[model samples]
Target: MSKTANAGGHEGSAPHLHRLVLFSDAVFAIAITLLAIEIHPPEHWTSIADLFGQMGHKLWAYAVSFAVIGVYWISHRRIFARLRTANGVLDVLNLVVLGLIGLLPLVTELLWEHGGAAAIVYLGLVTAIGFALAALWGYAAFAGELTGPVHRGEALFTLARVAIAPGLMCGLIFFALNHAWGLILLALALGAFIAGGRYMRRQAEQAVEIDQPEEASA
Candidate 1:
């Protein structure tokens, strides 16, 4: 079945979604693996004490990077799950999003090695992905590529849900620019992101539920 309610007309569009999602999954897997390769064993290993002492930030950074990439992958999966039909534009847009995701490993390592402005770049890239995500949702809804019927209000709700990531990332970047404790602020920012995501997803779900007709709901 198509992910959207009214994607019947666009079923014949070029580039099957199967291929696109497969390619996207490959990219995501590679990026996640690269995150581990970025982390190296402590050099001149001696004992548990030396190992623990040497691999301080690297461990923390790897954990954080892993979490970050995982979040992106989950979001990407959800979006594609909703994809009813694929056309050239939709496939290209998805590829663009994948391209940005592919850069996360490199940027994550850079952020770990150099913290002054790399955080800004990293968050900025995430924000771009957020925008691209918003764009994808907007296009699918507007182009009638979604599986079910999507009203304008419901579409806006979907947009808001995906838009939360970049919006908060942008705010965090600004927070870091003016504040001395950028690192500490990141903890707060991440917490806020989690909270916001939960709230937005709930809102979108409610909207979709309300819009889905009783007969069509089944």
Candidate 2:
């Protein structure tokens, strides 16, 4: 009887986690679709040059928003792949991340319509999303029986990967506050993100080396 109950519990928990992932995926899909829907072609363009010029802002906004949302989708997949189960708190945290993701299209529109002046608002939303994702990962990894054994180095690397770009972008955007300089800040943020990734990867490797000996003996 006890064995049957244990098997039933395990079966039930997996479906719960599966349902959560499916719902999150649907939200991501809708958000990306909304972004593309926001880009409408110019109604009256005489030449290729005129068409390109008119569509430039919309195209740029769509590209950036697509890339950002794509990254979060990948990160979300990675984080959930590491989990073994979910609790109420984990469910709430997942929703928080999804909720922030759902706002990207609106912010992308703001960027398209207002240019650099709207960047702070756009990047601020991104920053919030990044931090919320980090928090969700942290909670799942550390708060009870949600995730399996997470390596220390890997955890640090994951946090750095998910959090650093938006944080840097947000800080830089505050100073630039325009479309042209916003591109410059993005380049800077990418460079810094790469450097931070390398540093975190090295830390993770060292952690693995340190743990290997202890793990072998045990």
Candidate 3:
């Protein structure tokens, strides 16, 4: 009886998981679309050049927010790919992450309009999202809710993966205090995150292939 209960709890139901993933994908799509709407063209400009010049900062903010949301979506997809089951705790954490994502549009528009500490609020939203990711991932990983092909340490790597952006954001906040180049650091930190995540995923997949050489060969 204990063994049966254990199996039921660990595996849950795949259909439920599929529905959750579908819902998540739809929300992410909507969030990305909303981000683009943050960049509004001015109703009046002296010339086309003036219009483009005024748009420069808004365009930059839009680009940053767009990339940030896309990264989170990709990370979410990657995490779900190796998930074996979801528990109540995971569900709550997932909702918190999504809630933070939904706030990006507000923060994006506010920062483009307000500047100043608005930048920090934007980055702080990202940091909260990162911490949520870490908690959700840690629960799934330590609870043995990861799939079979996941390497022994890959989930731990994921914890590290989601943590990097927030850690770098702290540096961004420092730079903002010292030099006002925080936006530049934001771009750089995101670039490093995308590059590093790809590398880590590739390495993990290769390790899995090596471990299951017979299946790999077949």
Candidate 4:
């Protein structure tokens, strides 16, 4: 049970991480609900098919955006689980990340309304903010060395997982020049990230094992 707060601004009595998680849950719920609102009801039978057909892109955009956001949240949780405490910098960075996440509904709406070009911009913005959060986490972990000596490799692996996002988004943006093909690339990137995370976890475990043996011998 760790307590944290925005040490730079607040009295440091409140737990910032818990607050962030609760706030994040609220925003994500609202954002997801907003996506359903984007679907317009058919005015008549004749327009029903047209409305439904036109919504394909919007639905796809919503699904993709939601999935990416979910992935980021999961990754954030995994990284933070290793920490014994949170610092002001990490709190600020988490706020920034959550702030960007709170904008997902609007961005998703924009992509649904405007299409691929808009999606590229929205995706870039989201990924950049996530990258910043990851950087801040890495910095905090390095600065505090909060995790025990055996857990340093876990920190590095977590950092590597975070680094993959911006790079993947950059590649997807470049490929999205082909529109639908680009969206496919984005999906592929997500798949690759899932696989990469599993691999990194195994590597981290191996590193822990190696370090343990040396420590034992000493």
Residue range 124-203, candidate 4, lDDT tens digits: 77767567767866766776443334355556666766766754765575467568788887888878877866777787
Ranking by TM-score: 2, 3, 4, 1
Residue 17 error, candidate 3, Å: 1.3
How many backbone overlaps does candidate 3 show? 0
Cα RMSD of all models vs. native, in order, equals 5.1, 4.4, 4.7, 4.2
* Per-residue accuracy of model 3 over 1-218 as CA lDDT, tens digit each: 22322354434557656877898888888888888876788988999899989997677677777777887787888788767666556677888888888898889888778876687798888878878878877766666454445555566667887866654655475466567677788787778867876777788888876878877778
| Winning candidate number (lDDT) | 2
Which candidate gets the maximum TM-score versus the true structure? 2
Please give the lDDT score for candidate 4: 0.67
Tell me which of candidates 1 and 3 scores higher on lDDT.
3
lDDT of 3: 0.74
Q: Estimate each model's TM-score.
A: 0.71, 0.80, 0.75, 0.74
Model 2: per-residue Cα lDDT over 42-118, one tens digit each: 99999999998999888877877887888899989989998777666777888999999999999999999998788
Model-by-model lDDT, in order? 0.70, 0.80, 0.74, 0.67
Q: Residue pairs in steric clash, candidate 4?
A: 4-16
Residue-by-residue lDDT tens digits, candidate 1, 1-218: 44443343345533476777788889988988998887888659889988977776666556656666676678778777766676656766787888888888888788778865687787777778777877877877776456445455556756775767554754555466578697577678678757765666677778777767764866
How many residue pairs collide in each prediction? 7, 1, 0, 1
How displaced is residue 31 in candidate 2, in Å?
A: 0.6
